[model samples]
Target: MKRKHTYKLILFSAFLAVVGCGNQEKKEVAQAPPPSIPIIQLTTKTVTGFKEYPTNIEGVINSDVRAKTAGYIQKVLVDEGQKVKKGQVLFKLETQALSEDAGAAKARVNVAQVEVDKLVPLVEKNIISSVQLETAKANLAQAKANYSSIAANIGYATIRSQVDGHVGRINFREGALISPNDATPLTTVSDIKQVYAFFSLNETEYLDFLEHAEGKSLEEKLSNYAEVNLILANGSLYSEKGQIQTSSGQINQNTGTVSFRAVFDNPNQLLTNGNSGKIQIPTVYENHIVIPQEATFEQQGNIMVFKLQEGNKITTAMIEVKAAIDHLYVVESGLQKGDKIVMSGVGKLRNDMAITPQEVPFEKAVKPIAKLFRN
Candidate 1:
């Protein structure tokens, strides 16, 4: 009986030992190692930042065609976008009525001359007073002046191009009445050999731009300004780059913006009076620190990144971004060269969390991921 009782106690001890070992194994499996996170050290790079502003292109000379005298349009001599020369007749007004009036005026002048001649002969023969001859001469002068005025009106009926360029949209067709007082123009003519790009910036941006430009005077600053690029509405870049020329020099009180002008050569007449595009101005930063935009996350409206610290820990850092270049950001403040930051998994990180840092080359970390998927 004593031996059987000892055997039962040994069996119970064995069962307990097996259960404790299983529990220890399970606990060890649940305690996983800290996750490895990719990290990169910040480094300076020469990057170009682009700022685009919507602009409308205009020919260097845009002239509105209007009738100087009221008349019905008898002809439209040119089509839209047609090239024309100065003094080319664009429209010929119906001058039948003016012609009739001019003929009547000429007949009156002839009749008045006959009367003046009759009075002069009668005065010479002492058959009429000198005052009567003078009156007849005055009447003859009035009729001649009237005839000359009517002839001038006949010439004014022909509408001609005042400039050398391409014709724009014709506002009126044949038989449409055009007047000098009309609000709408007959058509527009544009000299498109070179184009002007008009763009605007807010007061704040204008001030910031002037502050960065290196020159003592506005003219010198404009001359020193970097060349700009034009992006067409169809998303194609223009062949020729443009230069910043003039500025309005005053803020528009109603819009709170300042206007700027840029000039571009349009050799092919590709640009017109009202072509729209975007002006892309590049801001170059030489040897400035840059980091991957993906490595950053917004917290409480501030841009932040997970900084790698001692003991392989990460803490949230606030960084001031000056501009974006491709998929990277140009750092202005709050970060410097030689600072280690988590390259990825920033979304899943918490403040002061321990991590396994997998250091990567700065160039590899900031490689534009967007370009990788391009066809």
Candidate 2:
């Protein structure tokens, strides 16, 4: 019975050893390495500084057409949106009353002239007093002046355009009684061949801009003088360049912003009166340290970046953001050109964390992981 139990135990032990060996063989097959978390190393390159601000486009020339005298409109010469020249007759007024008044004054002047002529012969013959002849002459002169004034009123009845531009809608149609001081405008003519962009800048920004302008090299200053661009209402860029034309005499105390007017050519007539768009004015360029926006992080109201050190350790460096350009941030301080900053996985990283940084494309490192999963 003992010998049988020993044989049974040996058999059980052999079975357990075989099972253990099979498990060891499975463990010996090397597992595939864990998937790598892609990362990017920071490198220095030339960066263009940009200032992002909202702006609008406006017409350089705009005028309201109004009636010069009160009268009933007789005829509308030009239709709305038609091109008109300066001094072109846009509307004619019913001048029947004005003409009749002028004719009546002319008849009175003729009668006065006859009396003056008759008195002139009498005064030469000394049959009448010189004072009477002089008085007759004065009466004739006053009557002629009244006739001339009446005729001038007749001329004011016709309303003409004061500028060369596209005519706006006609406010008063034929037979409508239009007044010179009416609340609504008669029409509007705008010279859309050129447009003006009006903008206001605060005193602080103005001083900084002036200082930058003065400190720049002559070539750079001249290059930036007329280097403003405009994005129109329909999201198209205006082909023409604009320049600073004039400014308001005094700074507005209430707003502390100085108003300025800039003029630009709009030969295509794409710009209209009161049309709004963005105006990109060039602020002076300076040598500033900048980094890609993907590499920057914000912590407790402080801007921070992960800088690589000698031991592949990421050191968090705080930065002062001067401005945000296209896809980057301009740093005022706390950075050097070749600091080898870790530009990816910033949220998961801590100060002095050991990282194995492989130089990866910035575009791929910044891509959303969910987007990759979807693809």
Candidate 3:
């Protein structure tokens, strides 16, 4: 019985030793140092915002080249993309039939003139009545008019450019029958020294644009508007600036949008008719509070950040974002200048959590991340 009591006492003492070691480990863990976290002070930054819309580019003057008289195309003098001046012939039509008719008309005019000459002499000699002379003179005038008409048509058989521009595709090559009544033009002449970009704004956008401009009249508002930039199809910005204009304020019934035009100089011929691109309009914010997007997390669809407090503890801040500039958010409200916030590791943090605050420069923390998506 004494041996049994001795064994029980030994087992109880061993259990106490294990419990005391665990208590010592618990106290050490509870007294350990807090985690170090990088923090940044909030600052306002100047940011530019852009609104982009798809646009259709066209030459300021897109003239269609068409034949005035019906005939087979005899010659195409110029090639596609050939630069030509006004009055230069583009295509020649087969005029053999018209020339033959013109020769007959000329002969008739000569015959009428001979008859009028004979009648004049006979009238002077009192052998013919004055009414007969008048009748013969009328025939001569009619014949001359018919010959002139035929000659004018022969001239029109050679299609000439009415504008100084570059030639487009030769739709009807040599030997193709083309007429003035044909649906398609023989070619198109585009004056691309200056280009026009056309875009549209919906009803709400149109009203908002006009409402923001500081002018009583639409003309004044457009004149006071800021210059717009073009984003080429290749995603590069065009080198030239453009001015906006609108002829009518009336919205289209079919499209339900207001049309806007921007004119740009194309000295290098980078832009041409049928080209496509985007128009970018800018709105500038002078000074606004900004925070790195990494510093914020979404909670219940609201953007949130951890703001540092006096006790080395952080509290959740719900920021009102004005615009998202790259990887940063422009704060509209909720966060003010001089407020310090956690710079990183927000995913591991909770509200009112204590941390060893490590100060980080405001620009140093955001610039590199912000530059990743900049234009």
* Top TM-score prediction, candidate number: 3
Which pairs clash (backbone N, Cα, C closer than 3 Å) in model 3? Answer: none
Report model 1's TM-score to 2 decimal places: 0.88
Whose TM-score is higher: candidate 1's or candidate 2's? 1
Question: In candidate 1, how many Å is residue 246 off?
Answer: 1.7
| lDDT over C-alpha atoms for residue 170 of model 2 | 78
What residue runs in model 3 are displaced by over 4 Å at the alpha carbon?
368-375
Model 1 Cα lDDT, one tens digit per residue, 6-122:
999999999999999999999997787779999999889998888899999999998999887788989889999999999999998888988999999999999999998888878
Q: What C-alpha lDDT do the candidate models reach, one value each?
A: 0.91, 0.75, 0.91
Q: Ten-residue segment with the worst summed lDDT in candidate 3? A: 366-375
TM-score versus the correct structure, for each prediction: 0.88, 0.81, 0.92
Query: RMSD for each model, in Å, please?
Result: 2.9, 5.4, 2.4
Best by lDDT: 1
Candidate 3 vs. true structure, TM-score: 0.92
lDDT of 3 by residue, 4-60 (tens): 999999999999999999999999999998899999998888888788889999989
Please count the clashing residue pairs in each candidate, in the order shown: 0, 3, 0
